[model samples]
Target: MIFGKKKFLAAVGDFEKAAGARDGEAAERAFAQLYQAAEKAGDAEFREAGPRLAALLPSVPQGPRAAVAVVTGACVERGADPSACAPAIFAGARAGFEAAADFCARWAETGGGELPEPDDELTDEIIGRTGEEPAIGWFTLPQWEMACVAMLGHRSVRRESAGTAELLALAERVTEASGHEFKCLTYALRVLDDEPLVVLHRETGTGYVLRMTGIGDNFQLHTLLAGVLIGGQHVPGDAPSAQEVAVCRDAPGQVPTQGSFNLAGPDGAWIFNEGTPSDIPVVDGARLLVLDPPPYRRGWPAGRFFPGMPGDLVLDRVLDEAEAAEWFAKVQPAKG
Candidate 1:
């Protein structure tokens, strides 16, 4: 080994101290050193330490658990056999530590990345979550809503990425509560100004733009809409066409011309403004989500505060499950 076991242990101590204290920067620096030491210590040394690291999992907080998980992933990447430590790691992972479980799942599904599978039971449990319901965090929504669901479509991604696992779990819950033949498409996208884009429908003749005003759990609202689609049964993928944009039935004659209109005021209000119409085709048989779409205005530096500007847009209307289902059914069949 290029590094002594004493040096590796010292690095581990520093990392644990930093992580325990919740000093993010210090923990990051310490982990870098720890990772380097582990790398240089060779496969035999890492294999020997694996069980010890697993034993530490239950006693540490989330931060240290994640750090230890990273180390495990590194060991697997370098061809270390983790069988001796797999049981403890899996138990801790199921208890919480998403990062650890995801790494294990990714390795199993992909055949241990550039290496080989670490253990059999770990692989089976990881794969089981995908096929079975009632997995971790899979019961936020009531089961009745999703009784009749059939399909779920999401981004083809591994669980290793942050938030992916939770998102899938939420999808499972929502699907269970849908209670109808449903299809869901859920995907992540760029968040603008700490908010998700709620509506951006543009048709050759008319369309509109609506933005969520960081008001009242819009994130939850976003997820609900996904479940509402496909009969409220499957995973909702990212916004179709552009960046997580929603397509609502356009409200005819309600379109304001060239200026900003406050569809609602102060509390629970929709600040609407009309802009250039898009050349996109209108889906036949769909409600008029917007009559005349707004023009794209980059609101930053100063313009964001003005009404009708992208930065100033807020929620104007919310559709219940019935409304959402009706609107989605009409639009779902047509191209817009």
Candidate 2:
């Protein structure tokens, strides 16, 4: 039978009670049952329950400062320093934002419609939350929002990084100012657009050794770097876009010798190349490298590489589902 809002809310209340009691496993099971029931019912009344369900769970706190606090708590629980996990969490949030965007794009395409304009409800929410809407292109809203949340989660753990602070401020401002309908994707996009670029300065005894750049393009690379730095697996890849493939194929010279990139971050740096044949460094992480041919070579097999701070960094660390489950298990309320 279909549930009314009252029934749904009551179910959520029951789950919340279970969660509060630290019966995490039981709560999760209850939540799963509700979710499946709602899905099976498939009515508009039940549909609104989705976000409510999320709200009942231990959310990654809303707002900037709160978000950082949550991440810090998680890191502390894991026997890892908050600083160590900050960047990884940030990267993970960014990956999530990107995933949301990809989902939006696919949704639009599959639905065979132009991007839907934000409804008054969403708009009013944004305006109430942020003073103004961050300027975001229509096509990029979903990706932008997904990335913003991931970054926000990261900032919640690591208190340093002026860039994180600035972005958070911007997110708040946007939330307060805009009357645009508040789609999570759109909200995230606005946050990213409002975020200031982060510049990493290396101080050598004399001056600064190398002017290390902040997170670069390729969201995937940032995702990889964050995973390794946090000692976790990288986020799973989304289906490659035709544009991405074309960009890879048509772009310039052959991929230089394997180890030409520098893949390091606040944690440390490492060198990778053909002779050493080490994994790609953070500098060249997520880059399409052409191997076996010099610049402008006729035809050489191009390889997709993800570089990182070298030292036997294994892909399994971040990408493993089991690890994610473990992490979740620790944070989630205890099983009933």
Candidate 3:
């Protein structure tokens, strides 16, 4: 009953081969057998394989499948034109599928634990929202496969509240399965709100305390902001100054500008911003800062470069120039 480590590895290789061959049927059979073996073995290693097994399986095209059923059923049940319901029904199902995929992928990457027992309450909620059973078929696909599905679904649902609702329904399942340990649900909830954003900046003495409003509900916005900040420091300006030109000119062959900011997130490290070459002291070697609606407040010392609203309460904190300069230096690329 004990499938040793070597045996497990062999089985995993077999599964991979099957997957690579695009033999979904064979892969499915291998995974099911592995699941049973792991369960019977009852060891930590075997237990760990459970999550991987679930991830390796194929995903069912739930959205399209659900859409077909809804359109057909609507015509008979409500005596409505299938054509009229096509768009709305398809949109809802698509959103649900996408949200589900995103949630699942996050789970897999962060260590998807054992699949939880079926929760009637959660399943009922999904069915109620989509008018069909939320099957476990989606969990069969690999994380990347699920991610692609979620991405397409996200595009379809963008700006549509019905899509938001469907995503919310999927969030409920994610919450139930993961016991809310993952941030996917949180991200999904934010996406659903689809609120307008207000960027927040505070002087950190070394750099500005960059925060945004609309992001409280948008996961993508948070991702975007984080990427920009971690990637590098940007000093916005209309023209390059002589001093900036000197810095780059002195460095000769260094280029002294145009680069990316690297930062870590809840997931891992990523590039935030890609900077451009420049010749302005503040803007030289600095990433360009573009405010959608330029800052509208002013209260700092006269002649001090104050972009955006000055004296505005929107900024969380403002770093002193010296500190900002120091921080920027640290993140700057090291000379060869």
Candidate 4:
């Protein structure tokens, strides 16, 4: 190994100490030497310490893209395994480290710099998040207002890139929620100002652009109309599309599904699902209880389950159930 453990540590310290530079130069400088040294070092110690050195990226306050340049640029220089560096950067992105997201977008904008196809999960993780790969921060919207549904008919896609595929996934989910059988014709996904936007093609004309905006707890996103096309004419909208999409938070369209589900566990018991508009929607169709949707599971995933639901009225959860248990016995109802 060319670079000693102490040397790698020092480089990492420099990067940590110099967070969010006007430009990523300082961090890059520090990381550059360490990465290059690690690849050529003759001793086993140098090679072993490299991945550990890469781990420092996540802990830094910002400049995720800088950290990326440090790691992957090293790969470009002499072919080093940049996998371990990805999650560390991902952790930064999850924490809302601005530079991390920038780095992801930048990396996607510019491919992995010819670093061979992903070799492992870590590499794949980086690719997936960069918006270059699929499902990086991808979310599905359950409710889309009816008016805009018509445009999807002629919508055709050119390719899936960045936020493009994710938006398409959302469109597919929202279309599904509307109970409309359809397909996504993705054209391109471009991350503009950190937002993932997609452009779609139409049969009669060119197409339109749509963006996904994340707003709410749980994995939820809403679509925003950004651009449009009419007979090959590109008409960029100065204002956001008037269309809207939302989560149907009400108990169910059927309104107050009645019956006792008798959930098995009390502490961990909850039954609910993301409400997709289906005639026999699982989350709403006459069930006694509701549970929060299980992580990453889509079909009728519960938003919240009415645990120990023994009340008949919708106000019961706030009144009757609370009163019966004397949980809020002193509280009075609004009417009677």
Q: Order of all candidates by TM-score, from best down to worst?
A: 1, 3, 2, 4
Predicted candidate 3 versus true structure: per-residue lDDT over 196-295, tens digit per residue = 2222222232355443322211112222443344323433322223332222212222112222222222122232322111110123332222222122
* Candidates sorted by lDDT, best first: 1, 3, 2, 4
Per-candidate clashes come to: 30, 48, 30, 26
**lDDT score for candidate 2 against the true structure:** 0.31
User: Candidates 1 and 2: which is better by lDDT?
Assistant: 1
Cα lDDT tens digits, model 1, 165-260, are 443454433434332111221222111222323232212221222343311122222222322321222222222221122211111111111121
Residues 142-223 of candidate 4 have per-residue lDDT tens digits of 1111101111111121111123344445444533333333221221111112122222211112222222221111111111
On the 0 to 100 scale, the lDDT of residue 235 in model 1 is 24
Error of 1 at 291 (Å): 54
Q: Pairing residues by index, what is the TM-score of model 1?
A: 0.27
**Native-to-model Cα distance after best TM-score fit, residue 1 in candidate 1, in Å:** 18
Tell me the spans in candidate 1 whose CA falls farther than 4 Å from its real position: 1-6, 13-30, 77-81, 97-336
Which wins on lDDT, candidate 2 or candidate 4? 2
Compose the digit string of candidate 2's lDDT tens values, residues 158-246: 23533455444433443343323333323232221112111121111011111112112223222223233222211221223333232
- Window of ten residues with lowest summed lDDT in model 3: 304-313
> So what's the TM-score on candidate 4?
0.22
lDDT of 3 at 323: 51
Model 4 worst lDDT run, 10 consecutive residues: 307-316
- Candidate 4 lDDT (Cα, 0 to 1): 0.29
